[model samples]
Target chain A: MNMNFLLLLLDGLKGTVILSLLTFLVGGTAGFIVALSRLSPFAPLRIAAQLWTQVVQGIPLLVIMGIVYFGPAIYGIFAVPPLIAATIAMAIWASAYLGEIWYGCLRSVNKPQWEAAECLGLTRWQRMSRVILPQALRLAIPPTVGFMVIIVKNTSISSLVVGYAELSYNAKVINNSSFEPFLYFGLAGLFYFLVCYPLSVQARALERKLNVANR
Target chain B: MSPIVEMRELRKSFGAVDVLKGVTFDVERGQVAAIIGQSGSGKSTALRCIDHLEKINGGELTVCGHALHTDKPDLAALRKDVGIVFQGYNLFPHLTVGQNITMAPKLVHRRSRKEADEIGREMIAKVGLADRWDYYPEQLSGGQQQRVAIARSLAMQPKLMLFDEVTSALDPKLTGEVLRVMEKLASEGMTMILVTHEMQFARNVADKVIYMRDGRVHEMGGPEILSQPSTPELADFVNEEF
Candidate 1:
């Protein structure tokens, strides 16, 4: 493999890392709202959130990326930068999965906690903020971190559509020139493994900590 | 004795089934009132309605001289004055015992952390749980957790306290410890409404004992109600244990 090709691989590493961080931060926030909406007492909000998750989850990531890449220009809108499109696409994807993860966490809180909060005379908002969210956050932490690793890995697919120059995109560029499929692809896979393995480990560790504490 | 809590012709139903049907009761200040009944008799529902946990379908409930659901009852404020301890000891699992005790005061009352912490420790100590201040709910035994829950309510400095079969989740040995905490609270002249099956606890502690059957107050009195029980329902309930 050429030295220039390896450098491209390194640039892809930067893209993957930056995009994953942005998705986790921005997408995690968006997902929290979506989760809350999905769990809303109002039927319309719940349906809207549920439909959004369903639609997002059902479509292929590649299709979503294409729509994200090209859909905005249909209204004579300004074109999105490649990085922005990738980030937006990944964030939307993260919101759907994270929303589902968090909703399950919120539901898993003990039933008695709700009744106890109600009896304490907590208003609905107070009950959620003070009593419910704190506990839900604990339950949510492990799965959320775990999902973040998935988000990081899936961002690789952005190479196909956005021209984002992420790890996979750079690897493709290098592979085109080198024609050495095994070496470059394996290196790309190694880059991904390097980025994701520690997060996977951290998430599992946190989950074990939660389980032991709960026990 | 002047009534502090009054429920008149109160009605509540879930879907098509009636849980409370024209139920009425009055609780006096500084009095310990225990509603004793079999499961599903609406004893717990009555307590819940008094605390406004269950929305009433029709009728009136006044707590500490204020009408519930009038002009959108400041629920947080009402809750501060009316504290409830549940059967499951619903202490917030993520928060420490001190945090659980201080949550209402700090959030609802806007007490400073320092003030809330100081008071939380005091309440925990009062319940004999000072050592468990930093412990989470899951760390403590069932009885210890219930005592901490009672302390959590006490931290609110409530005018009225409700216990919904608080000892039901505990073993017989642990039951006495929790009941003793209640006994102490009652001796301190706190107005309390307890829904419990512990006949001896009711006979010994309650200023008023109400025997509920099928959502209505079937019979009521002091120790005399327990001693001279006449109705077959009450007789059957009393005989089951004695």
Candidate 2:
């Protein structure tokens, strides 16, 4: 309810946005590589990508943040900033899941499209870039936008483990000072909704547009 | 001149079941050969092998002077020379009809956008779909989509074309429209191999008719073979409605 506290939360919202955007930029690039590796003809590359997704999916993000933030200290390198650690941890975690999502999208493209491209004598790279990826990208947009909402929400997990001053962390600080869990947490939830609801709505709109086009 | 496609004792198997057993055939330049047979008789499989869609277990296949029997065949070169159309008309659903037609020419053939677009328009006009060039595959009817697919293949200017039951999924009117396109292609002296159930079209348009039985060429000759009883298998196949 306090204006100062509201400003504090707004400042924290900035941190959340920065962290989510940075994590997605890093994660999305890695995720694209992971998705292509999962579909790679080379056996070892596919296995390595599969193992990465499995390991990251198996571990909780809180644990990953802890390891990323603290594990380097045990190796005598303690200068790792909380923001950098959290970003690295979140990028790794997000890439695994995003990679899996996109892998499914790439595979969802009909097999005949691949055959058609091959019969046209397109090389492997040409087939993927020109024929296959263009189609897969269309199928991927709705889910990829939907996943951004998850990424934004998941940034809060860094506050719990890495002590990153994101929205949830600032809310906790406010609650500690005011001893008002209801007021602070409620405002935090509101801030999250403000950021994520638009993404969810946009994702749905894209899905409908794609379906109509397909029809 | 060497044939566009030459297969001698070509054999293919799916696990333990042999689909094309020692199938031998040759398609000369500008010739349309129709391969007809019952289901599981390897007509489609043989057509597919020419495109390297199916790997052969034994024997020889040479298409456009590239030997396909080798472990590392020049598949890109082979495919550049061969264009294949399936019964499903597997056009890229996301791209416009013009984009679909120009994809291979622009990417594989390295044609400039203007050149590809010119060929796209030419092929679209050839298929009588000039008005629908900008439309998506989902917007077109099945027959129109199939014709766009034919134009897509033609844009590559392939030396030989393969059709695998391209009209099997079409209604009678749609089939007639697609068959008419093929007849037009044949009249233009495009080299083609078609695996078809349309006996009448084979009789009328195909320069050579190869009747396959259990993966071997049971009888092969000109269109006259359709009426003559050179073999009982051919006679039975001709009399029966596929």
Candidate 3:
């Protein structure tokens, strides 16, 4: 309820930061691969990527975390750490959503743009890297930053069932012992806002810049 | 050498809608063949087929010595010898006029940055936009964008160039600017096929005019054919344009 509780919550802050960063890096890469697959010329890759997006999106985040926590143990792969399990579930969750968001962005590029790139004799990857992705990246920044906020907040869900000692988890434990839910939880919310507000501002600034350039 | 492009009954369909039904034509090297037609006459579709943009469902299409009829045509090689400009002026919006022209050249030809910049400046100058190298597509007027688009294609130095109504989206003055650049390319003897509504430009510049009607070449002959049409459909079409 005192300085000790504040210090303990700060210790928990370390895990949340690490978990969020790892999740973003891992998920962003996987999501990009998934988005490309969705747009792949090969039919099977496109179908499989479509299926992955649908199935992952349909499941609840809590269940996904639970499955990651216990699903492996059923197959004799036990002792997966809470943090690692949470990271996997979070990544899987973020990939499907980000993949869909980005696929829409990429496809939104004008059809003639694709034809123009192809007609220029660029290899497939060259067209993507030099033309399409640069344009799509502009459309993607706002939603992607918005999703990072979701990712930060979603880390709290991991603590509920998987027992990961992230920010919200330690705050909950401290409040349980001291019976001071208002101050600790309020402080936790403040920390969450502090982490996410700068990202939102940057996204808005980038979006404005892109719009002005487009204008 | 064989003709730069030979289309014998080339066919294309989109979900039971036959866009190019047995379309046939030939374009010789250094020949400017203007394809004039209405919206549904499949001129753009046919132009796109030369670069394997749209697969021909039946018959033969050969461009720059590559047969385009096969299931797995070497599109990369074919495209290397071909460049296309679209009605929408599909210049990469994120890139400056200079970069838009130089990007493919740098990637495909692997030229040094200095050489690429030289190519960019030269091509941009050829298109009469030498001063606007740093301008982005959105910054340019439609006509200017179309000119930049032409310059982008010209930088590739393709054996054949296809313009699918390059000036269709521009105002008369802007279209004139774009047409002037294209006229310079024609004067330079670049083999070109253009699907255009500009009957006057076609009459003046095209060596051969293919007046397409209903996905078929209704009339084909020298530029003189534009003034004296052999078919009622072409005469009507040309009359409407004038």
**Local accuracy of candidate 3 as per-residue lDDT tens digits, B111-156:** 8899989988999889889999998788889999988988898888
lDDT of 1: 0.87
Candidate 3 iRMSD, 1 decimal: 0.7
Per-prediction TM-score to the true structure, in the order listed: 0.95, 0.97, 0.96
Question: Which prediction has more favorable DockQ, 1 or 3?
Answer: 3
The stretch of ten residues in a row with the least summed lDDT in candidate 3 chain A is A206-215
Off by over 4 Å in 2: none
- Candidate 2 lDDT at B38 equals 96
Worst 10 residues of 2 chain B by lDDT: B233-242
Report fnat, model 3. Answer: 1.00
The lowest-lDDT stretch of 10 consecutive residues in candidate 1 chain B is: B69-78
Model 2 Cα lDDT, one tens digit per residue, B1-242: 99988999999999999888899889999999999999999999999889998888999999999999999999988888899999999998878999899988998899999999999999889989999988999889999999999999999998898999999999999999999999999999899899999989998999999999998999999989998959998899889953
Per-model C-alpha lDDT, please?
0.87, 0.93, 0.90
Look at candidate 1 and tell me the lDDT of residue B117: 94
Of 2 and 3, the candidate ranking higher by DockQ: 3
Model number with the top TM-score: 2
